[model samples]
Target: MTDRVAIVTGGSGGIGRAVSERLAADGISVLVTFSGGSQRADDVVTAITDAGGRAVAARADVAEPAEVNALLDVAEAEFGGVDVVVNTAGIMRLSPLAQLSLDDLDAMYRVNVRGTFVVSQAAVQRLRSGGALINFSSSVVKLALPTYSAYVAGKAAVDGITRILAQEVRGRDITVNAVAPGPTATPLFLDGKPTEVVEHLAAQAPLERLGEPKDIAEAVSFLAGPARWVNGQVVYVNGGIV
Candidate 1:
């Protein structure tokens, strides 16, 4: 996969950054994308390049089809063609079903569901044979955690898209899969939670600890590169949280 390229949305976030660096380490050129954090994305590029890997940073709103198409243009222009597309861009606004704000719920769906759809559509059209599209879901979909109904609903859409897209891409040798991570030690998961709450969630996993970003990245690396037989499956990377 030394000559292959990837486009990773939300590439500046905790899990996104880990996946970006991990792919680079595996000899894949990465196009690191950020919606607002240009500096953070650039830092990821710098880290990759400084480590003797290849990377470039750009800004693109994953929900916008035009912007996503432009990103594909950049990847092809920069590194020939895209072989992997990772949809890590998502948002979470916790509220119960009765109390959930429509605005917040719409925001999550826009970024998590619609954003994944836009990018996946583009990837299915543009990715070369042997390519892979990895979408993001959450173990919370199964865990059905309180106050996460809206967020889980959006990810549930992602699950459906992954399964259908894999079948739709038949004979192309391209795989579509979703990674549902359980409680992990990312800012997205840790931001507003109390320490005791975090500890309790961590202990719910058989691993008895919070997941590191690298743990999820490892699963992504497999799907993106060598795991050709793995397709249309939602691999849970949450250390047995179910």
Candidate 2:
């Protein structure tokens, strides 16, 4: 992936930050997009540059087409052209179906499902030949955990988009796929949970531990570059959690 350019939405923290740094380490210039955490994004870019990698941070809301397009323009202006797009921008709100708030459901839908679609739409339209578009899904969709109805529904839509988009872009030489991670040790996963709850969830996977951001990033590294034969699949990177 050397000399390639990538735009990673939600690139300030968690899996997004890991993906940005990993891609930069592989010689891919990165446009790290953040919805709010400008400092975190800048820290990622600085770390990459200090390590002799190319990266820049930009702010854009993944759900808005104009903002997404503007960030794409930034990528083009900064690194030449977009060769890869990773839609890691998402929000999670947990609630049982009967108790779930419509407002929360709408928020998740806008940022997770609609956000992925908007970013993927732009990616398919503008990404260069041999490019790759990777979206984020949750292993919880398969696990069907309680209090996750809204989040799971949104991610299921992302899975649908990933599958259909691959076929829609046939003959374009661009790959579309989604990565489903389980029990990752990111702030998003760790926040508000009791320690025992975390431990139990971690033990549900045979690996007996929470996944690190780097673990998810490794899977992304494969799909973003050399995994040409792998398309339209929701890769489960959950250490046997399924």
Candidate 3:
């Protein structure tokens, strides 16, 4: 995979940044795509370059098919063929099913489910032999949290897509999989949660701590690398929370 090109959406965020860095360090040319955080994305590119890894930042909303296709074209132009795609671009809204609004469901579906579909579809078009696709799910799917009904539903769709796509790409040697993280210490996790509540969550984990970004990144790296046999699965890196 030394000469492969990778596109990592939401590469500006905590988990995405870690995944991008890990892949770059593995000698892949990385295209870091961000929807809003341009500065953060550039910073991640700078860090990767400083560490003697190759990376560049691009802007795209994965929910848009045109934008996703354009991002793939850019990667191909800059680094030849696409080999891996790590999709971490997603939004979350938490509310009991009774209180959930249609707008919330729509917004989350656009970014989480539609985005994964668009990006993965585009990536498969450009993915080379032995290529890999890593999509993001969440541990909440297994845990069945009450407030995460909509968010988990979207991710559950991703899991279904991942499995089916694996079969679709069976002859191409392109593996499709999802990495589901559990209560990771990311901005998404910290958002809207009180300090006491966050602490309580850490205690609930079997590991007695929240998962780090690197924890999930490492799982992504393995699936993208030598563990090519691990396909059509959602590997959960949740500190045994479920």
Cα lDDT, all candidates: 0.94, 0.93, 0.92
The residue pairs that clash in candidate 2, if any, are none
Looking at candidate 2, what is the lDDT of residue 233? 98
Off by over 4 Å in 1: none
Alpha-carbon TM-score of each model against the true structure? 0.99, 0.98, 0.97
- Point out the worst 10-residue segment of candidate 1 by lDDT: 87-96
Query: By lDDT, highest first, what's the ranking?
Result: 1, 2, 3
- Number of backbone-clashing residue pairs for each candidate, in the order shown: 0, 0, 0
Between prediction 2 and prediction 3, which has the larger TM-score? 2
User: Could you tell me how far off, in angstroms, the CA of residue 158 lies in candidate 3 after the best superposition?
Assistant: 0.6
- Between the candidate structures 2 and 3, which one is better when assessed by lDDT? 2
Cα TM-score of candidate 2: 0.98
List, residue by residue over 7-47, the lDDT tens digit for candidate 3. Answer: 99999989999999999999999999999959999999999
Alpha-carbon lDDT of model 1? 0.94
* lDDT for residue 197 in candidate 2, whole number 0-100: 94
Candidate 1's TM-score reads 0.99
**Model 2 Cα shift for residue 42 (angstroms):** 0.6
